[model samples]
Target: MKKKITLTGKILLGLLLGFLFGIALKQLPSGYIKDTVLLNGVLKILGSGFTSAIKMMVVPLVFVSLICGTASMGDIKKLGRIGGKTMLFYLGTTAIAVITALFLGSILKPGAGLDMSNMVSGEVTIGESKSLVDIILNIIPSNPIQSLANGEMLQVIFFALLTGIALNLVGKNAEPIKVIFESANELCMKMVNIIMLFAPYGVFGLVSSTFATVGSDAIIVLLKYILIVLLGMIIHVTVVYGGLFKLFTKQSIKPFLNKFTRVAAVTFSTASSNASVPVSLEIMEELGVGKTTRSFTIPMGATINMDGTAIMQGVAVLFIAQIYGVDLGINDMITIILTATLASIGTAGVPGVGMIMLSMVLTSVGLPLEGIGLIMGVERIIDMFRTTVNVMGDNIATLIVSNSENDLNLDLYNSKPLKKVA
Candidate 1:
């Protein structure tokens, strides 16, 4: 336990020290370090590499875990009902989140006074999709192996669902396949654990590189925009999530929040919910969410949940409107809420996902694609927070939904954390 705490503490401290070191490097004279390289370069490389390593596991982990999850479901009809409820809940919450953001953004109008005309376009590029058909088609992988290799999450999800369903139908014949997949799942988890060991180095690198490139000035320029985005996120997490938790579960929000706050903090710092999954699952189980519920909801939530993404889309659409001096009529706002909410489902669960969804939102509102560059400088910084909220929302939904379905285990949830297995 002591060793585990120390490791976790070191990871956290490294993230903080790395970020501070990065900011300090921004003040140094490049001439002094012309010959001798600085810590920034090292940190940036480590951070990016760390993120890549985490992403490296995303495809396999999601695919295998999802397959195992579906295969474990012996009843197809029950699985269908749970899936339908989950999707509807996810979609409903997402729509609510967007509406909240749209309402808040319109009311606050955070971008009104900002001068973006002089700001140069950011380096981030947005991909263009010609139609909804193309986007839908992209979800069906032509080759399963290629999809996994490419890390196409949606396609991977599609294939995993089918494979799991097939395994379920095969019954006793699928036992060997299930055992093999179970082993693969365990191996993938071990890979995640191994990658987590270097989390500090990766986090440091990512933060250092981000600050070095953007500097603090870009933050200053977009301070209001950032604040508004954050405020919107807070509202969704607190008001939306809190209310739902209380209403559905009839449990004290205090205990839930108390236990999960640490997890949320870690998610906030790490910015990869997939990376945060192990912790989130542990926390939820501690909070008394049953095994079936945790197993079913958490993985699915990780795959499709995007309340945070929805909020970002809402604010992003309004921000673009403000920057371009366009007033989005009520109809336009409604369209944005609908498009952003639906788009969140289709968006991949990876870094820079918000930007892609933002492009889709901007196009929906008739905002210039060029305006996206203005926000690009600060996108990475904000992504970390957005992802944290996304994961939190997923957990909250799982707990609430599980409680409502009478599948929750209140006693075990409030008990001590389980002993870590060797």
Candidate 2:
């Protein structure tokens, strides 16, 4: 009899092969083969297609699953409590992330010995960020259909919640809609499984193309900065998340960690928190979170919970400050923590978003915005790890909220979750 490999095994295999292939391509001399053929041709198609598939599914999944989950809550107050706890947990973890990054950045001194003469002349235009009032106003969509069409995640979420509340208030009149949403949710899951079948190749294309273009030489040059950020991410995930898991459930973290390994690969490969939702929800369900909690929290977490991005920005601010030999006072550090925590909420959970938020943090502390260009070369690679941490944070928030609400199934958490084979 032949043995089947789990999704984690497949993703790891794809990641390894992609890394080797990309590294090999980098060794080749500059030509059409390296530039137009592989980079622009095959890899682009696969990576783009993979991303498109996830995005295409997000609207339907978030809309349907959330509606079903919200209506099932049976009380409007429950929704508010869940939302409150989820956001509070998200904000708390984000603060911890920034603190960890700052501590590590100070200790590692990623920018102390850095040579900036090669690219110090670079300049970047920092866009005017919206005010808090404006961000809040924008959440109420003018047209829910148009918001859904534009992929306005926050607006869609807001509208969905209102609709769900209305359905809950109306009771039996909403049963038909609830029934439809439940069926749609199942359909979305089926689509996710179908999408996973192509995940290996998609990841291979995405990772290989990214490493090939970034090149090993550039990555090696930024090794210090890379290591510092990764170390902070590791500490935040294990210590902060592990602590949260222990405090809320008093259960071992091993099972959740095991299930999340596969989803982390999705976040890393896709470099988008939105793209990781299906897998995150699946993993949470397998690890014992009820559908009501999973549906409401997972989508909301991806939209507003950006702990990993916060860590990158928090550390980047210090790194850029160090590169320019600027000294930061206690006030500057406090400003960075506040700005980064807020920025994570408004920031889009997508690839390259950390850089944009980093600009906000730097500008808040009067650091050089142009300093971003120094690390932009290797940002894509670092983003993969940062995103991995973000996905884990989302699940951790879900677990904590569920466990507290008694929405967790301890039996399922105690038993191993079944794995699907390709």
Candidate 3:
């Protein structure tokens, strides 16, 4: 019989087992195990290794896939159209996400009961904001090689777009370059497959460490804040995405949600949309997105589509405001929504990006930077859920856009799954 298990299933099992073990350790007095190598060394290594492996693939996969995507466009005007539409959709959804989050958070008042005196102040300082000119200038890297080396995603995207456009301009001469990039893209995906085989172990370590460190008590302490964030995420995924699908494609949400279940599970378990890109792209294709739409939209969305991050930023701002006993004016609320939406695009999609963007949101509203500390302990755990929602939002946007552009193939979408990566 063929192997029945999938990478996603294996990762889910890992997460489940790891959480069980962590809870057991927490409940039972496993002082010896805690003091011994399991807690300090083995667990940390596994978690770090998984993250490092994912990060290792990010720069190469993005650069190659982006080059492939852009070059495959064949027409620069098509690239411009797709780019414009994708950005508009992403930015619009981000704005909607933050607004919904702010609205829900205000109604719920998640921070009202929290005691501010006991909460620890965050030590990390917010960075200085750049002017629009500076932000634009920074997009063109002085050294493209250095940008990739440093994993500067925006700069890398900029460079890749330019290269792809230049290649398109070269006409037949670009064939060899396109071939090389396509091959590299295939190789990088293979690398992702190889890395994913170790996913069970990696997830076990990461989730175990995360739960052990955060403990259930922290969840109790921050229950209100957590619930509000989660509620906002659910609203965005179910309501906003659902509405978009109905409005654009006139399709039932059932099929989309069914297809999304698997991708969302992987995204939640791994907590990195960049890491989840291969799976998301695969699922999007399976859900009827054409090669062109999937290639262009999914990768770009992985880079900048951040509904989850935006919602978190908004809720976090409200949580902080409530904790500080500050009443935010209407202007303040609008400012938060705009700031979070823009920051979602501007911020890199690496780990801790939500926190960094939260700082930006707080800074825009004159909220205390120190307020971040209150939530840092739980940020890692929260990030997993937020990112799952982020990936889901991206896929939904891609589907809607594909349908709008008449690029989706409903027959292919309803077909059986693709052959699993060997």
Return the lDDT, model 3, position 145.
Answer: 98
> Model 2 scores what on Cα lDDT?
0.86
Per-model TM-score, in order, reads 0.90, 0.95, 0.93
Per-residue CA lDDT of candidate 3, range 1-422, in tens?
57788677787898899898777666655566684677778987887798788779988888887788788778888888888888998999999999999999889998998887776644756566544456677788999999999988889889988887888889897898899998998898888878878878988888887777775766788888888899998888878888887888887777767777667655665678887777677677677787667777877888788999898888889998999999999999989887777777766766677877787788888998889888887888789889988888788888887877788887776666567655
How big is the positional error of residue 116 in model 3, measured in Å on the Cα after superposition?
0.9
Give me the runs in candidate 2 sitting further than 4 Å from their true place. 120-128, 417-422
lDDT of 1 by residue, 1-422 (tens): 24356446667777678678777777776753621355534554687677777777777777777788789878898678767777887888889989988888999997797776766554656876335667688889999999899877778888988998999999999999999988998898788778777877776766666666665777888888888889988888888888887788777777777676556545655577666666666677677775555656776777678888788778877887888899999889888887777777677667777777888888887888788787787888888788888888778877886776677887765665567764
Ranking by TM-score: 2, 3, 1
Relative to the true structure, candidate 2 has a C-alpha RMSD (angstroms) of: 2.0
Query: Number of clashes in model 3?
Result: 0
Q: Candidate 3, after superposition: displacement of residue 105 in Å? A: 1.6
TM-score of 1: 0.90
- The best candidate by lDDT is 2
In candidate 2 the C-alpha lDDT for residue 240 amounts to 90
Measured by TM-score, the strongest candidate is 2
Model 2 pairs in collision: none
lDDT of 2 at 241: 89
Worst 10 residues of 2 by lDDT: 119-128
